[model samples]
Target: MKSLLVVSIVFVLIIIQGTTIGGTRFPTSDENSNEEYTYVEYEEEESSEESTLPPIPTTTSRVILSTELETEGPTIANEFECPTNCKCNKKITLVDCSHQNLMQIPKNLPQSTVYLNLSHNSLKTLNVNDLINCGELRQLYLNNNEIGKIVNTEDFAKLPNLHHIDLSTNAFKPLQGKEFSKARGLLTLILTDNKDIVTSNVPIIQTEKLKTLYLANCSINQLPENIFQNLSSLVALNLDNNPLNLTQGVSAFKPLTELRRLFIPTVPRHIALNLCKNLQVIDIINLSLENHDISCFLLFNNATYEESTIRTDLFKTPTDPPSNSSIVVSTTAPTLSTHIQKGTEVLKQYANAAANQAKTTYEKMSMMYMILSGLVVVLLVAILSVFCIIGSRQLGREISYRKQNYRKYSAGNVTVENPNYERYLIECEKRQFTNE
Candidate 1:
């Protein structure tokens, strides 16, 4: 009777077990579907949040060129007859005899030569006899030579049409007594890299038509007062790489009323302001200033201040006075301080604009870095989640397989007479039959 009762109970448990196994299979399928849904939701949320971020600034298509073209090309041969150890153009208007070991000027040059280059040679002195015939010469380059002194002022003064001269990198002595007076029609002069002239004051130049002067890298310490008084028409002056003491007076440039461009040495802010007060072209390279001076320079706005300070005349037009009656006209111009203030404002504006551009570029780079960092982090999290999910599913499957195997072995080892063991055996056999 106990065995029979056990068989009936076993039969009931087999039916229930089969139903529970079927129900457990539905849950695994549901878990798989939930995993897919979670993945889709995570991707949508990530994309939607990232898309809401502000777009970075970009250059316009109109400004960006599609392709870049190179301007460099191979050299072409000249068609004109060139002199031995010299180069000349097709029209024979210029001659180049540079880098040659000759001590004297080349003879029998074309009569139409207007530009002559005899630089980088072993010449020590310039003789009048050498250039007496080239009257039409306009530009002469005698730089990089051993020329220590000019033979006479009259030798260079002979060329009435000479306009430009370059005597840079030469060892010249202090010129005295009306030197360069003959070359009064000259427009430009370059005497750069001459160390001897820096020891003493250079003699007053008397060129009436001289417009440009370059004395850079000359090691000059001080400029004599009224040094530029005679250069009324001078437009550009380059005094860079000089060692002018800040304590000394800088009145040398005061006489340059018509000067347009100035390249002075690094000096105190006050001195630089005083020297470049009236100039239109001022280079900031040679300026040495303290932090407070920079603040002061940036704070002053000359244009706005000048406009407010200046008073406009109420009367639009004055009635014409009798020509013979003396009508005095006020000749006073704007003060030097006004001009200095105005120039400083322009430089400050340029500096501010450059600073703003740099800040914008930095911000853009930071944004890009942040975006890349976020993407890397998201990718790592996604990979870790995938690995974790796979590992958990594999562990669950192993545990379930081990439990089933343990039940099967225990039921097979149970005593045949035990009703409980018999009941478990029936359940196991029924499960295997269902699987089959």
Candidate 2:
């Protein structure tokens, strides 16, 4: 019974050792042992309870789809392969793929994208077909590209919500029949720096809703006579740097009666003359004129007039009075009649005063001349006295010469001269006889 008791005690010790001690190859800690054995009792109890308990009843809400999903909805950005360094943010619905070396237009752009900037790219032409999906696009920036011409107008016409389009520096050519007429909602069209673009008449047929048209540096030599006929709603028309020859008539811009601001490099003399009746604000920095008839109209800033002849009729009517505005008429033109008349009147007054002064001077000069003549007469009398004295001296020298000759003849020292002396005496006697 002692051995049995001892054996039972040893078996209990072995069981305890087996539970507490790990194998030499495997490591275990006191904290790990406590953690591993403590959850076993609770897990077993929970498992028993779960097996006995009935399953709780549950219900789910029916999935309600959005109304946008029901209809043909707008396209999302992730559907397309967007370029590098560009992200399509769903919250803002913006796709910024600008300044990328994209040769072709990006396809599958989100229809929800309201603003699209494809500027500073290598796009040669605008493929409108690629943008048929962007129905929600309102503002598009296509500046700083090599797009030559707009081949398809239908693509732009389909965008009903499009209002502003910037095609500056794209080298676009002249637009043709109703290309932009279908864009009924378009208000602003920027086509500046398109060197080869020559617009025929203002594209006013469809631009009734357009408020601003920028054609700066578009190489337009002449605006069509009826250009402003269609742009009745236009408030501002920028034609700066365009080679507009306004000599055609002032009526070229006659249709722009409501235009508040006109941007032109030069306003033709005739146009400038008539522009006072039309435009309120005229910006003509490089104005040149063949005639100065329009000098009265150049009462604006930066107004320059090249060397030109002034019309005689300029300011002749006096109907157009000078205003408070600045007038930069070139000094090269002929003076106005009013200026000449004023100058002549002043000069005539000066000449009359000068003639009176001259009359006084002449009277003084005449008295001085009489005094000088008296002095001259006295000097002549003194000179004549000196001349008479010289003449007397010369007569004395001749008398001395004659006395010497007579002495020589009387002394008989000149036997050959005796006959000559006698001949001279006979000649003197004949002269005295003739005188008697």
Candidate 3:
């Protein structure tokens, strides 16, 4: 009877240990601690949920945990559905599957996932069939992967609410707009630092609603006739590390009437960016025309002090997009409040741009003054030299006139018709007649 009682006590302890914290703390499991997030655990996961370590999947069940969160009070980890192999926060609907060396998309992702990060992984192919589970996905990060190209454009149709895709540092180049043709609400696309974009076609991006684009160091050397035909509403453009020249009578930049901040590497002497109203010198001048020196955006922005009309769009970051009606997306999204601070930064950038512009104007004016002073000095010297020559000629002529007058006076004044001897004889005869 005593043995039976002890066995029951031990079984009860085991059960108790599985359900309670037991006065032990496990580390938090989020890699991106850059922002605040509510932590959660899988219903099936019990002990590992308290650990921040990346959980290894078991044969029976994958045990993912987002445990022991800070900054937010109390964890409702039991309320969320999560896999054992990744971190999940159901309150914000964030699933971070990054740095897991995932060969393929995980099948057990929470249905409510909104922000899915599969970056820094070994994903080779992105098949759209796997994305049917997260129909409400908004921000998809597939950067630093082996995805050569999107398999099917139609598959992206499943994620209608998707926007803010990052395909940087991937082999998914030579893009036609069809790759994201179905992502109608797409706002931002980052395709920077692609090695295989040497032959990227002109007008690579055809997305009209695109606001921010990062194409730095993409080997873009030239523009087509209608390269920027579609992006009328583009805001910020980073064309750094390119070799483009737009002097070929191509209005590649005219279409970007709504364009605002244009980041480039340098402004060559002949480079002109009249559309850019401000100028600030930075490393790695992004070229778009004529040896990649100057273009329209650089010229216009650096020279003018106009307040950015794009401020509303630049400062106003959208709030969490509503989840699609068909699916409950992840809720872990950036607080729109952060954009308020970013808006302030925009003001600061304008101030800095203004200061830079003023400094540039001062330098130019100083240079011009120096040039004009030199020209004036040169002109003054030439005028003085001519005056000196005239003065010398006048002095010589005056001296010659005085010398002739002195000679004529020394020989006694005589009329031109009267000879010197005749004047002397006439004077002598006049004296003799007077004496007689």
Candidate 1 lDDT tens digits, 1-436 = 6445544554454334323222211011111211111000011111231222111111100011112212111212343334567766555556666778768777655566567777778888876557756777777778778888777568676787776677877887754525677786676677777774643344457677677676766777777775566787676676756676745646777666556445454446344445445343332222211100111132234333222121112111265222231323233323424434444445456668889999999999999999999999999999999999999999989866555544343336672333345566788899999999
**Count of clashes, each model:** 0, 0, 42
Q: Cα-based RMSD of the predictions, in order?
A: 37.4, 43.4, 25.6
Q: What lDDT is reached at residue 358 by model 3? A: 100
> lDDT of candidate 2 vs native?
0.53
Note the Cα lDDT for every prediction shown: 0.53, 0.53, 0.53
lDDT tens digits by residue: candidate 2, 84-193: 44444443234555568777777666667665667667788887777777787666667668888665677776787676676777866666536677676666677777
Instruction: Give the per-residue lDDT digits (tens) of candidate 3, residues 49-139.
Output: 1322222111111112344312122224546455545665645367777778988988755567777777778998877667767876766
TM-score (all chains, Cα) for each model: 0.46, 0.45, 0.46
Which parts of model 2 are misplaced by more than 4 Å? Answer: 1-92, 199-205, 268-270, 278-436
Q: What is the lDDT of residue 31 in candidate 2?
A: 14
Query: Weakest 10 consecutive residues, lDDT, candidate 2?
Result: 34-43
